[model samples]
Target: MRWSLTVLAVMVTTGCTGLELLVYPSDVLRIPEDTLHNLTLSLTFNTTQAFDAALNRSGSVLVVRVVPDEEWKLKIVNTPVQFTAQEVTEAACKTVMVSGYYWGHTRLSFYLTVNHVDDQFLPGVLLRDDVVVVVDRSAKLLDSFFIMGVTLFLICNTVNMGCQLDLKLIWQVLRKPVGPVCGFLSQFAFMPGVGEAPVTGCLHTTSLTISMFQFSYLIGWLIFEDPLQRLGLFTLGCCPGGILSNFITLLFSGDLNLSVTMTFISTLSAMGMMPLWMYTLGTSLTSENNYMKVPFANLAISLVSLTVPTGIGMFIKYKRPRWAEISNRLIKPITVLILVLFGAIGAYSSYKAFLMMNGAMLLAGLIITVAGYAFGAIMSKLCCLKRDKIIAISIETAFQNAGVCFIVLKLSLPTPERYPIMGSKDGHQASSVKFMKNVTFGPIGLRTSLWG
Candidate 1:
């Protein structure tokens, strides 16, 4: 009878020793996903006496941790919270902070325990909250700056590129159709094949380029285990040459006329090619392809952006030859300044995204750019094109219109799949830019240019 009575007394004492903490207001918290700074939660004991009991039996410190935690998600800012028995008695409530990293919903549990080694008291996790982290629709400072800078740069640089074009050379090159044909093959055929992206139309003739494309497609099919990786790579390869290519071409003293011409052709063709590839190949990547639109408005804007500035420059060249010459001299320096300015800003703004990228994705981006240059150079040489033409074709082939990819991914994929691909594409865009010193090409000498 004495043993039973003692056992019952111990059991009652053990049950009463567990400390429980309660949250005030509610057990659920709704906060913005962008809350990386801190969020204060009001913590209180389950009963008024619980705090005093904890201090006497457990200790003065309470350790807290988040369950199912990630660095990109909810995390405790500091370690175990410290307190004194007198402080607990005097304070109204205790507060703790948790950081919200990304957009997602999770049931985060705050486990609390005493920081004592005496084993006199046991701690219980009584704080379980349903955290709903919604997306922050607020406009960031860097985003606005990036947009404004890019827009201003594009308008100025495109006009500058147009001033470099020699209409007679463009006409002559078009008439012969050699360099344009090579560029066409490099962009549409060879690149897509290299990326294992499906082409919109079938080629009628058999040639080495065709064989290379098929071979590359075969390689990509066999090698890439993840379909999403193929989709991202293929998307990058399938895009037309961006305006940045023409800027790059001018800096390198490549055939500006050829580069401009090829850029126009590929971009115009992209209206049809982009949709076709997305519809067919996109289905293979994910079923969400059905909901994807062609973004025709963006394509039209691109075309207009390319042509309007160039048209103005061409008029300037025709009517005021002196102004054109002066402008050409000034344009290269301005281009270099713009590149340097944006490169620094971009690096600063995108450091977090870069941190999220894996090493394999970064290495793959480099390989894709290098392979594009190789294909363009080899194909141009095989076609017996001039050095300037070779350089132009290579620049055009290697640089994809990342803006187009951004729109495509944004509109096409769901949020879960979209962000990762977008990040990978951003990494690719950063890697693909091959900055070079201004050099000599044909009659133009850029030895005195800023980069030189």
Candidate 2:
């Protein structure tokens, strides 16, 4: 009998120790378990009622609300999930894991609650919480493809030497001394108070020249209310000329060599001019906090990329002129096709923003183009340039580099605070398209009619 009692006592002691080990300490709960239980029960009743009221009032909530628990693992998933308040409550009580994703910014809130009736021994604790997860997978994918296509285009354009610059002739023009001076004066003299001379005298000149006109008009007239829009317009105006000027000059039977030389010089000048102009003008226009950060790395990359292709083209011309000629002929159609594809892809990605565009944007774009042509003509005539040079000057002065303008806008403009609206990226794309359209159908067409 004594042995049996001793064994029973040992068993009871072991069982009590095991129970103590399993039970969480009161300190871990941050309060006594009984007190916590009572508080949790009260909170659960209030929270459930509040959530039900919110559901009825709003009709639907896109954001995911999770109950925080010590063991529960909350995460964001690409795939979307839908659940009612009751369903969420049940899941909170039963599940240890929850995952969800939403499109826009989400608001998160947490409240602790407990089920008193269902869980008698250990109540079902629910720490209700809302979580926000922004998924940029689609945007990332589109950006990747866009970058890849641009890289390919750059490689192909370089290999073909589509806009090969002649160093020997450039050297000859520089040696003349008067030629460089005259070119510099012609570019810088017309625009005053705008510190630092225009660096890009190529394709972008016309757009930029017109943009200067627009900037003056906006500041003097106050056409746009938003400072961001005004800033964007100013940036477009200030962008340097591009190689497109050479092509346009060629099409018009203008001085192609002079245009090409000017383009090369202007592009080289951009390394300094772009940053200087942006900083000086940008500071005056907006608060220092909102000042646009120039992408110097991107600028350097652009210069290097263009230079490599140009160098390759020059090499081909020197070593194999006949082959280079054949390649140019072959590449022209391919280049056109690639451009079309790029346009289509760009349009597809930013269609929503394009659709949101207003008449004011289109009008602004048109004004920019028309003003460029008018100013270029006046400047060329004033300079007393010959017919071919005059045409070249006019073309150079009128057409701004849409690519540069687009890049500046992309880098500098602010992202939309809200989703599904025309943000910085979309705004730039839409504006670029509009500018290109005006150049193609408006000024270029008119120039062709008169000169071609």
Q: Which stretches of candidate 2 lie over 4 Å from their true place?
A: 1-137, 140-143, 162-165, 172-221, 243-254, 331-335, 386-392, 398-452
lDDT of 2 by residue, 25-98 (tens): 11111111111111111111134444555345443322222332321112322112233344333332221122
Worst 10 residues of 1 by lDDT: 1-10
Model 1 residue 86 lDDT score: 42
Assess candidate 2 and give its lDDT. Answer: 0.43
Candidate 1, residues 393-443: lDDT per residue as tens digits?
998988777666656655654442222222334332112111000001100
Tell me which residue pairs clash in candidate 2.
203-242, 203-399, 204-241, 204-242, 204-400, 204-401, 206-397, 206-398, 206-399, 207-400
RMSD of 1: 12.9
lDDT of all predictions, in order shown?
0.57, 0.43
Show where candidate 1 strays beyond 4 Å: 1-64, 67-69, 72-75, 78-96, 100-138, 193-226, 288-290, 416-452
Best by TM-score: 1
